[model samples]
Each structure stands twice: as C-alpha cells, then as structure tokens.
Target: MSNIKEDQANFTNGFYLETHKRWEKFSNWIHCICVVTFDLELGQALESIYPPHVTLTKQETLNICYLAFPDSNSGCMGDTNFIVRLQSCPSKAVLSNVHTAYNSKCPPALQINPAYYWGYVYFRQVKDIKLPRGYFQKSVVILSRLPFNNLFTKIISVIAPEYFDNGNLSLEAACYNIDQWPTPVPGLTLSLPLLGSVFQTFIPHQRNSTSLILQLAGLNEVATSSENQIQASVEDLNLFDIFQPVLSHIDMLWELVITAEPLIVMASSPNHCSLMVLALTRIISPLKFCADHRTYFTIHDSDFKQFTNKVHGTPPVILGVTNPFFAKTLHHWPHTVRLGEDYGQYQKYKLKKNGNSKIFDSTPGVYSSYKPFLQKDKTMIKNLISGINTKRPFEVQSALLKKHLLELTHSFMIPLERYIASLMPLLKNISPFRAAPTPLPFNPDDFFAMLETAGPQLTTGIKGDWVGLYKKFFRSPNFNGWFNNRYTELALKLQALQLQALSDADLKLWVQGKPEVEIVDMVLKIKNKIKKCEQHDIPVSHTIKEQLEQRLQDIISSLPDDLKNILQTS
Candidate 1:
C-alpha cells in the first residue's frame, strides 16, 4: 500500500511537470508563427480562442495557420525581394505537380497550441529573399502570448469587473499566447489592453465618455486663455471695445447608440485604459495649474465640497432697531460704556426721541421713557426688532432666512455650473462677450430675414465697412474682406432663423396655424431655390439651406399640443 501511494505521488508530479513543459513548447510555437506570418490572421485566431485549456480542432488549427501566413501583401512579411527557382533533376512538370499537392493539402488557415508549438518555418520562393533578422524577431515577440493560468485568471476576475463572470476560455488562450513569448518586446508597453481584455470589457462605451471629458477640458483651456487675455487688456482699451463678431466654429460630435446602459458599461469597463492614462496626465500636467484661478479651482471636486461646508456653517444675520433709549445710549457713548449716569442720560434722550416715534406711541407716554433697554448692536438690533415684529427668536429667524437664501443660491449655481462645464468644449466657438462697446443683442431671426431680403447687397455693405476700416488703420490690403463679409452676413442670418425657431411662442403659433402644410410649402420653395441656384450657377451655400431645414424641425419639435393636432389633421 505504501509503495502504491508513493508511485501515485510520483505520477502526479510527473504529470504536472509534463503539462508545464507542453505549455512552454506551445508558447514557443506561437511565437515562431507570429514571426513568420505576414498578416494579422494568427493573432486574430489566437484572440478568438478562449484561454487556459482551449483546444482547437485540427481544422481550426489549419485555418489559423493559413490566416497567419497569407501569401498576399508580401511587403508585410519582409522587405526582401525574392524569386522562386526549382533546382534538381525534377522536371518542371513534376515540380508543378508537387506544388499543387502541397497547396491542396494546406489548410486555408492554421492554428497551433501557443504552449506546445516550437517549430519555425522559412518562406522561400524560387528566388533569393532578403529578410531582416531583427524585424522577424520583433514580429515573433509581438505575436507571443503572456502566461496566464487559473490563479492569474482568478486575480484578473477580481481586479477587472468586466471579466468576473465570464468563462475561462479567453483567459486560458491568453495564457497560452503569453507562454509562447516569455520576454517583452522593445517599445511595446505592457499597459496595452490585450485583445481578450477588450472582448471581456466594455471599451467602446468608455471611449465616448473619455471623448466628452477631453472635449470639455480643451474648451475650458481655451476659455481660460481668452479670459486671461481679457484681464491683461483691461488697462488698455477696454478689451470689449475693439471686439468684433469673430467667426467661430464648433465641432459637435454625435453618436447614435441605441441604449444608455451600453454606454455606461463601456465607460466603467477596463478597456478605458487610454482614458485613464489621459486623466492621469491631465491631473499631473503642470500647465493645468497655470490656468485661470477660477478654472483651475473649479476643476477639483474637493474644493467645491469644502466651500459648501464653510458656507453651510455660517449664516448671515440682518441688523435692525430695538429701544430708543438704548439706541441713543449706544449711539452717543464715545466707544465706552458708563453704567448709571450714562444709562439715565441715555434714557432721557430716548424719551425725547420716542415722543415722535410710532413704536413709543404703543406704550403709555409716562412709561415710554422707561422703554426696555437693549444694547444697540447690528446683530442685537436685528434680533430685537425681528423678535418684536416676528415674535420669534433672532437665531431661528436668521437661520431660516440664511437657509432659504443659500438654497436659492444653490439652485442658481447648479445650472450655472452645468452650463459652464458644457461651455468648456464650446469656448473656442463663442466670442468673448465685450462690456466696453456693449455688445448689441444680435437677434438671429431678424438678422436672417434681412439677409434673405438683401442678399449680396448686405454682404457688400459689410465688406465696404471693413475695407474702410482696414485702409484707415493698417493701410494693408484686405484680400479676404469680401469673403469674410459675405460669410458673416449669411451666418448671422442663419443664426437669427435658428433663434426664432427656438422661441416657444412662435413654435406654438406656427403649429396651431398648420405647420405641416407650411413646412411642405417651405420645402418646395427651398427645393426650387436650390434648383434655380444650380441652374443659374449661383454660389448659394448649402449650409444655409440645411440650417433652414433644421429650424423647421426645431419648430416642429417645440409645437404645442393644439398646434400639433392642427398639423396632424389632413
């Protein structure tokens, strides 16, 4: 029995060692294939297989090999130009026959166990091929997989929320690939997410959030710069005075995802490694600290939380009136208080003053002089008056008022913060609101209507003004004056239309008066204008037309129920 137990132990140990050895061999094989393959097939195949104990069928293995070593795009494999030549007594016919047989038997794709495969293949056409050993070696390193096992898999599951519940197939395959190449490649960082990691995690979702964050950060940076410039220019001509409607452009990125959950999942996934890196870089970047104080201070969540805490603790108290005698005493005392004499003098003075006051009238004239003596202090006065009028303690009234004021302030702040945050990305497109030459409230609808009526005449007028200004100041050529004027005029007009469409009253009125019918008529008019413009070879901008169409849509969206019903009819 003892001998049998010992044998059993020996057998188990040997089996474990052999398994390890097999995995090592497989890793080597995969590395070699990666080096030899010209295409992404092998890597993709490895990615498709689940990890750990993953075993590909014979067919699957062949398919993987074929994909890895595609004959097309020889440049990817190596820069060596080579020609194939058959030597020996074998007839051309015989060589052709052999080649055909080899090709027929070869699988469309090839797969090999990353752990056990160690063989290498050399591609030789009938000619001399010049291959770089270093390049081949680098490719091999890239293709090799990292060592992953059950233990590693468990660790990954715990660390990466996306992969926790998934099966071990992907992990096993990744481990096998890792075993193929034990050494890391130069210039290749380990931080890159493996293909398996991408599959298991929602990377795509995180990408969107990261993009938005980056965009916001960029806008904030621009706004900060502009604000700084404005501050610096304050001593000079009011920065706002010389400001013009700078033509600004904003790039709006739109993605149509079916659901929000997937977006959230992607944002939360491990695949957002790039986003994490970006966030870290931004946090550590020295330039971020140099930004405007408000912007720099606002970016941090902790600072806002601290401010809120401080404001919450201290409540604002109002100052008011109490007793006439005490008030007089408080007012007359020359920075010092005397007890009996001063107090009596103060009372007499208060009685004379109280004769004319309504508050003293409430009490009998004789006792009015004996009015309650309360020390005159802003807070004390406020408290006494509030208590007398409200019939409540000063502290309670102040606390309640402070709480209400804070709430109102907070209500205003939340939306402002959100808007400011949103504006960060759009800062580049928004011209600074100038205070010096008070900015004219540019009505978009009115502007567009004028443009439609005036066309190039209005554009020319703007250009003439700019040209006159340019000649007066710099005496320099204004080559772009005409183009800039035309574009600006058109843009302002379109802006006006967009603003009008956003008006709730106009939308409601339009909808009630048969918006659908109006829309159809408008579409027809636009189509005809577009056709005529094309026919006449007129340089009408399509962008203006598109904006007009969008305004129609906005109007439709904002239509009231009664108007909507009218539109629905017929």
Candidate 2:
C-alpha cells in the first residue's frame, strides 16, 4: 500500500511538472482565434448592437467575437472574446444560399448596413513575455501577466484606443434547482438534473467535423439538416433555486477586454459566468463559418435583452448572461425588429407571446447525441439518492417516492422512448439510400449500443433510474413493434437527396483532375464495403475483395506518368 501511495504521489508530481513545462513552452499570450460566421436574422440581430469599425460587402452579415479568455481552470492564461460585424464574412456563399432559401424577395446581393467592432483583451498574468512576431492588428491586444487596473488601464488607453472608455461592466449571478428552475438560493434545493440542460453549451464547434465540412459545402438546408427549430413556449421557471450555488473558483486573473460605448451590460454570478463562457466556447470554439447549432435551445445575448425589456421590466442597454441563468426568466428573444428601434433599441422588443416570436434552434448534430458506456455519468442520480434523507417510515416514504418517481418517468422517459422509437424507422430507411453501393444493414444491436453509450445521459430518477426504466420498456411485448414502426416519412426522401449531393460533389472534384480526391473517393468506397461486412457480421467474399483491388489498380494506372512512377516507387 505504501509503495502504491508513493507511486501515485510520484506520478501526480510528474504530471504537474510536465504540464507546467508545456505551458512555459507555449507563447505567453496564447490566442484562440475563432471567427464565427452566421447567416440567420437572429445571428444578425445579435450582431447589430455592436459599434461598427469595419465595413463588409452586402454578402457578409455578422461576425460575433469574444475578445478575451476567462480566468479559470481552462489551461491558458485567458480566453473568450465577443465581437460581431456586418458584412465581410468568410462564408459568403453559405450565407447567400441561406438568405435565398429563407427570404425570396432579397436580391442576389444581400444589402445590409455596414457595421463592425474593434475588440481586444490583455491577459494580466502574461506580462513577462514579449509579443511574438507578426501578431499586430487593431483588433489584437497583447496579453500580459499584470492585473487589469488603473495603471494597465492607462497603458491600454494609448495602445488599443478602441475599448478605452467602456465601463458598464458588472458581474451578476442567478440561481437554479434540480429541475433547472431558478429557485431561491440556499433553500429549496434538489439534486441536479440527470441530463445537464447546460451540457450542450459546452460542445465545441471545431471538434464537430461534420458541421465544419458541411459549412464548407455552402449548402444551407444540407448543412443545417440536423438542426430542429420550434416555437418557444414559456414555462414556470423556479427563478431562485440554484444547484451548487458556489462556483468552481478559478484562481487565475484576467481583464475584461471591453468597449467604452456602454452598448452592452453584462450580469452573471461566478457559476453563471462560467456557464456563459462554456456555452460561448462550445458554440464558437473554432468559429468556422458553420450554421449555428441549437437555434432553438441555446440562448444568446439577444434573448436576455428581450427578457429584461419585455418580461421582467428591467430594460437597459443590453444583457449578456449564460443560457442557464437567463433561460429561467425568458423563453427566447424576439426575431422581428420594431419600426423605430435602432440596434440598441431594436434589442428591446415587446415580450408578447406571438407563437412565432421566439425561435428555439437546437444545435447538436445526430452524431453528438450518444456516448460510450464507460464515460462519466453527469446525472449521478443513484449516488444522489443514496445520500438522501430517509427519516420517514420506510413503507410510507417508499410509496410516496415511488409515485413521484412514476410522475417523472411519465414526463421525460416515456416521451424519450417514443421519440427514439420514431427515429428507428428513419434509421432503417437510411440504409436503402446509403451512398455506399453495399449498404450496411441496420443493426438493432448497434442501436442498443448507442443506448448503452448514452446510458448516463438517459439515466434519471432516484429509484429505478433511466437505464432500468428503459430496459423495462425494451422488454415490453410491443416494444419491438414500436421500435420497428415508421412514424413520419418526411425525412424519407431527404436522406437520398443528402447522399446524392455528397456523391455529386465528390465526383465533381474527381473529374476536376484532383488525384487526391479520386483516391479518397475510392478509399471511402472500399472502407464502406469492409465496414458493411463487419457490421452485418458477414465475411467479405473473394470476388468482392478482388473487384475492390482491381478498382484500386485501375485508379493507379490512370494516374499521370509522373504520379504513377512516384506511387509505384512509394
């Protein structure tokens, strides 16, 4: 045991020592440059409030940016800067197509008032290091290790000169309960929800390759096909209850790289602020010109403005708070701009429930939903229940708890089961139209594996929990029927179209004399064949293998003499 303890201690110290060395090797001022590009009007409205400093052509709409990093456990000294601009976007083609799809009246030229913002953030703890070569720009600020104060403030006033005067910066915090309701803090507390409502807010965009590839494809419908939009409906949010009211304290230091115009007012408690940073980080991590995910679910700056101005009667400049904190107060921001409202005034629309007023855009693509079984469980319901008080008589408490558990089961679990059941048919139909010539058969076991992977997220309740409940339903006599049934065929034709589009685009690239593209095409084709056989639990026939090899040889023979010689030699 002593040897084991010594080994563990040695390993811990070694890990920290290595991590510190890596940090030292990196540039003192580590910059996470994310360029967020969005086409939707909601994205535009969010950007409208920023003071303009750059002009872009009509095709460009908005560039929402984060100027600096939060002082937290997030490895680097600082991160997270927010900025938005109208015009001059990298994804002009995608935005143009989206504009045409959504608005028919607009000309090929997307005319909008030119607007921009010059934002910068200097990290306090990064002062010892000098700026690296080629890092100068009006928008860029050198991060330093010195704390943000009047002295550093004086220095920035001369250097950056843009955000020298913005001072409406204030920190505010809100509370929430087990049900994600904003209950009063320190009382009326409950265990955190099994599925973290804020988990989506931490999904980094760059990490999701599907979104990035689709964004590059410049197809609006195809790129955003995974998204689901719905009308926002207000619910009774417990506005005061908060779980783990005390935030995970981050001992790092940072200065809010802010603007002086006072166009926006931000409020958030420490935890709330962390969630906000996390949400922003998740959404804009790489900030490639992809369509925003969670159009229905993730709350933005515009949402807070609408809630405060219309619902809560605390209308001010603008509000930038975390989704979890702000969600308890308002459902969504108004999509329509009033006649006389300027960018700032435009943010404060009347909070009337017009059914169409609010848009809930859900972000996660289909691939983002499931996790392997071995991952950490976010809900921790069983553990929480184990820690619960059982002072009452066993029979009475058990009976009451069981009834309440049933209610919860009926509310969330049943609907989830039904939703998953409905999707199985879609999954099954997809096999027929799969781009691959040899489509892999849909496996019930694979679906079951997905469930196992997502066990932690789906698991809920203090008693049987989500996994046990799902198993119970899975064992039901009619479950097979339910899982195999086709509910809606709207998405039936869509899968074929998606597959065709991908094939057409890839073929086009191959025809353009891109040997690499052609090689990739063949590789994918062969890979799919192998995958299909493996998934279906079948062996690949010799004839099938021979044909694939011949195709590869044909592709190689067709290569240019110089390339063919190089390939042969390699």
Candidate 3:
C-alpha cells in the first residue's frame, strides 16, 4: 500500500525540441497530445505533454485521465486502440458527417451544440518485474475535434511505442512530420505522412458512406458543411467485420441498426468494444441511422446515470458497453449482444430482448425475432463461409461483404431518391405571373403506388415488404431532415428563377399598367426575397436590388402632394 502511494506520485515528462511547423497548423490536425502511464505502485498519472511548456486546467486534465484509463479491470492483450468522446462545451469544431449523424430526435447529449470533439487512445502494457505490479500500463491520447479514425490511429501506432522506448524527442519528430500533412477533403485519396512512412486512404463521400441527410435547414440553426466527406473510415466497417460475431442473423441485425433501436454490444476488451460499435454504425452506410451512439462506454463513464436511470432520462438509442457488470446493469436494455473471442463463435452472440435475462442466460444460437424482410443472398453467405474455412485474407472477405451491403443500401435509397427528385417543380413552371411554387407535397401513399409499379426494377437485388421499414424511417429524424433539405433547396431554386425573371424581364413590364401603390408594394416584396437569399447563403442578385431601388425612387417622385408628405414622414 505504501508502494501504491509511491506509484501514485510517479510520472515522467518526455524531452523534445520545438519543430519549425506553425503552431496553428498543429492545432487543426489535433487539439493536443497527452501521454498517461500507470505505475504498479500507483494508479494512472499524466506522464508527459507534447507541447511541453503549457499546463492543463484541472478540468481538462481530469477529463483526459478519465478517458485515458477506461478499463475497470486488469487485462492486457498486447496493444489495443479505441475512441472516446468527452462531454464538452460547444466549440467551433463541427464536422459535416457528425452534423448529419444527428437526427431531429437525437438524444440531448448529441443535440447539445458542443461542436466536434473526441479522444482517440492507444493503450499498451509491458511486463516489468521491478515494480509493485508485474506490468507497466501506458496509453497515448489525442484530443481533437476531428474524427479521422484511421489517420489518428495510424499516427499513434507510429508515435506511442517509439515514445515509450525513446522519449519526447521522438514524439516531437513525429508531430513535425504530421504537421506537414494537408487538410482533409471528401472524395479524394489523401497520402498521409508520419515519420518517413506514408499511408493512403480514400475519404468516402458523405452521400455514399453516411446518412442521406447532409444539410441542416433554417438560418441560425446548426450549420451544415458543404464538404461531401463523411467521418474518417475505420479499417474494418463492412458486414463481415461487424456481424462476424453473429453472421447467421446478419440481415436481422441490419434491420435493427437501420431502425436505430437501442442496442448494447458486449465485448471482452475495450478496443474490440469500440471497434464493433464503429463498424455497426457505418455498416448501414449512406442511410444515416441518425441515433446518438457511444463507440465504447465503460461503467465509469460520466453518462452512466443518464443511461441506467429511467427517472432522469432514457439511454442512448445505441450503445457499446464493456465490463461484465453491464450484464446485470443493462439487462433491461432492449437488445444486448455478448461476443466471444475465438473465430468459431465470432459468428455466435448472446442477443437478449424484452428485458429477458432468461433469454440472456440461454445458450447462444440464432435469435431471429422473425424472418428478414430483405431477400438473403445464400451464395454470398456460402462464399464468406468458404473464405473463412479456406482462411482467405480478412481484407478480401470484408470487401465482398462491404460491396453487398452497399448494394443493398443503394437499392434501398434509389427509389426514394428518384421519387424525391420528381417532386421538384419544373424549371419551366417558374413565372413572374405567380408566387414561387411549393414542393409537391410528399404522399407516402403515392410513393407506395410507384413502388408497387416499379419497385421490382429499381431494387433488383433486394426484394421485401420494406414498406414497413420505410414507414418506420419516415418517423425518424433522418427522413424528416432529408425532406426538409430537399424542400429548402428546391424552394430556393424556384425563388432564384423568379427573382431573375423579375429583375431582368418582368418587373418593368408588369408595372406598366399597375398603380403607384402597387408598384411600391412590388419593390418591397422583392427586397424581402433578397433578404431571404442572404440568410440562406444563396447569392443575392445585385441586378434585382438595383432595379427595385430605381423603381421605388420613381414611385416616390411621382406621388401626389398629400401622399408624398405622408410617405416621406413614414
């Protein structure tokens, strides 16, 4: 116990020289870097700082420490990496995909405006006999608003172990190399650099890899990013990786994730726990589940009360929790998936529903609530099985599963995407003679009619009474958000055209036979339209503003003596 007290006070700072890279550049890639280590005699302590001179506030240091050492028990299997998000005050760092992840009914945690934020950590432990404990525990943490999952993980892999053996000098060199990297843009393959090694990754387009709803409507509302890139991809996010633990019920799980049901994924380790959660979230790519989810949650996480206590609030719609304690604690959660390590049972999982622990305690087997609505591709499953038996490279198997899932997702979105486009008012329909047209009101019945007629052709690979799924999604925040954006975009287009025709071709001619008061009203109306344009970030037409101003002046000069005095005073 005295040694434990001694361990508690043990901490070491790394030594390094400053790099030539600009300070602000370092910040854009990552907010700050932290290194934490555990002395067997002690618990966890902050060991070093990357930008060595600065000191952290108590709040910041405590937050990092909490996230740094998340595991409740002692178990180290080589090295593991995972992600954590800290509850923070609203910051300026909002990522486009993170924004899209929030559906209108998003949990209060996500709805809070605290912008993009996260902590990507790499934990490693090495045996040390000279200490109070047999092993020395250490972890490297990066605090950043960016969710460059692969990129950050790669950065840690290069820096952490080397810093462990060497010191701050090695860490500084790695940071310098990273500082030279370019800003992330969606849809382009970026060649990232770190310590003389380069890694290439293609940032998936948000439209292709994340929810369809990409923009937020309403000015002074949560702003949406124009970049097409969704969040950074994890190395493994395909069905093979996510559902590998329960391949038999792959289709059913897909339905569950798409519907954004409350789910708990149990795993043996924090890294596996976090990876599974990230993969599940992305597997329903391009559909955007829009539910609040934590990649990895420990029993000690700050939100424990919010999750377990129904009196305060309900739990997140989706969660990935570690620690067997959750077995009893969250037994009441709607769905729980307990995982096994060996590849054999990776396909088998404990799935509990309706708060039934008997079901929870029951032996692992296929737990299908009902047959999947989407037609299953038996051939694909056989190939996956064959690949596993033949021991095919994991990448090849994961790729095949990914392609199939994307095909299914695209199939689901196509008819709806096509139908949504049809609702836009025709360009020819715009006229100064009338007010801007409203988007054709969405009629689910009409869409269903079209599906009945052409659904088979549009979704050749997937056949089902997905009408239920689609209807369920209609009540979700994602669908509402998508429709709202489409409506706003189309409405703005209609107004733009009307403004164009009125400024160059309609105003002068339409006012020819109108009264002075009516002309004044017309000018005021166009002015209001310009204001809306500015609010939505649509380019305002100077031609219209100038023409309307000229018209207003003409009316004022021509007004009768009595009316002129009244107008001037008003």
All candidates' lDDT scores?
0.26, 0.27, 0.61
Task: Report the Cα lDDT for candidate 3.
Answer: 0.61
State TM-scores per candidate: 0.16, 0.24, 0.73
lDDT of 1 by residue, 1-570 (tens): 233244334434443465646555443313212222333333323323322244544533443343232233222333221111111121211312222332222211111112222111222222224543333311111122221111122223322232222323333333433443332221111221222332111111112322322222222212233211211110011111111010000000000010000000001111121122122112211111111111001111222343223334411110111223322322221111111211111121112222334322333111122212111123433443444455664334333333322232233223322322222222223321111111133333443344344433332221222222212212211113222333444444433333233321233344455656665554344444445444433333666556544545555455567764554352
lDDT of 3 by residue, 80-179 (tens): 7888766554434353332333322332112323343577888877687976677767889887665555667767877787777766656666655555
Off by over 4 Å in 2: 1-277, 280-570
Q: Please list the residue runs of candidate 1 whose C-alpha ends up more than 4 Å from where it truly belongs after superposition.
A: 1-55, 69-74, 77-570
The residue pairs that clash in candidate 3, if any, are 4-41, 7-42, 8-42, 90-114, 93-116, 211-288, 245-346
State the TM-score for model 1. Answer: 0.16
What is the C-alpha lDDT profile of model 2 across 342-428, one tens digit per residue? Answer: 111112122223233222321211111112222222243233233234333333333333233224323333444444543433333
Q: What's the candidate order when arranged by decreasing TM-score?
A: 3, 2, 1
User: Candidate 2: lDDT of 133?
Assistant: 24
